[model samples]
Target: MSLTQEQKDAFKAIFIETVTNFAQQVGQATEKVFLQILPLTVVAGTEYLKSYEEDLKTKLEDCKTKSQKIIGALSTVKEPEKVEKTGDKHLPLGELLGKRVQRGEDWKWDDQDGGIGSFGKVVGVKGNGWVKVQWESSRNENRYRWGVDKAYDVKVVEIVDDLGDIPPLEEQIKKPTSWVIGKSVVRGRDWKWKDQDGGEGQIGEVIDVCDEGWVEVKWKNGTVCQYRWGGENAFDLKVVPKPKE
Candidate 1:
């Protein structure tokens, strides 16, 4: 977005005011001691003026930088439709689609087949609080619903801004397999660190197996994550016999 003429004028006035006030203050200070230190004062005042000019230049540059940042932020402001409030929900399509999100606080992590801390991208909107999400660990798109109350609703999907150490989308969309739930698996000896779900050589139970080649594993350490198996030569895991109690 381009700045309005009024805004440009306002900024120019501010810069002029700042420079004029600073010059006036410096002139007044120098005037008070002008006669007392005439000879040597000229050289010292020249050096001091040079330093002051440099400092003022830096401050002006900083102000310009801050102004540009403000303009950039204003340019990114969502349109009316993007912030349209639907009851308690304030997010619009501009904020949700293509955004990274995590399961909400009220998600049924334990009761459901999925694990906690899963992340996904909002790929489509079905309106009325429903959205299609392409989960980070699977290629299939799942439907997620938003709650009426965004602050304390069970259906809220938390937006994730920083991805941190999450695996890339390229590695997450592995081909599907025919693995069954309840099967036990361990990291194969040939498994590399790059194929990690819950660390190398860790034993885990198959909590859920989707047709999209995504196998959700609950590790001995209680951490759960999805991994690739079966198709596309994804041989990172080896099925192991369940240990008897």
Candidate 2:
């Protein structure tokens, strides 16, 4: 469903205000200072701005994940009707029919599966076994009728069901845990690192402060895991709580 006008307005207000604040903070004066220091930062250290970009993205994704989880939990009572799979849940008519011809629940796309070269996103569910999808007629596929049949292969695309509730402000805050031995965040960001929930490689202290990504984490098992910054593919960032709702 499209966002309600009020919701849209609220999002607009928050987004615009936050952007304005960021712009003011990073205004011309700040940019000049950054430019002057850029050479020194580059030579003496890795550009922090680049890493900070990732830091922002990580925090945003984490917020989204938390939102999804909370939405899922509160959804039972607040959004039972939302359980219906509209977009990605329902495959397109052609894709659906093609799947019927040949079957694949766990189907995967590889060098083989004829990609949805023509198939667009699934828009709505038509009647039984039929789904409406956005698609342009394929020249080689004999018009849109090429509706992926037994001929074409399948691939799954991820689509969210709907925009969940933004969540109460309190849920956005970070809670501390003392079960783990080591508590280390990214060099600059604030995601605490832990080992497998608890125990083993759980305790660590800063043996020495190194540059950028490297931090020494001692597991409870007394084993040291060395990281080269982006080593784990996932970097943690500090959590900033939104204003109380």
Per-model CA lDDT versus the true structure:
0.55, 0.36
Candidate 2 per-residue lDDT, tens place, 64-156, comes to 999999989755532112223444433444233211111124334331223434333332222223332333232111112112232222233
Which pairs, if any, clash in model 1?
176-212, 176-213
TM-score of 1: 0.27
Q: Over 4 Å off in model 1, which ranges?
A: 1-176, 194-201
- Measured on C-alpha atoms, candidate 1 has an lDDT of 0.55
Candidate 1 lDDT over residue span 76-135, tens digit each: 753333334454234653245445566665454342313566666655554455555666
Best-fitting candidate, scored by TM-score: 1
lDDT of 1 at 237: 62
Model 1 clashes, total count: 2
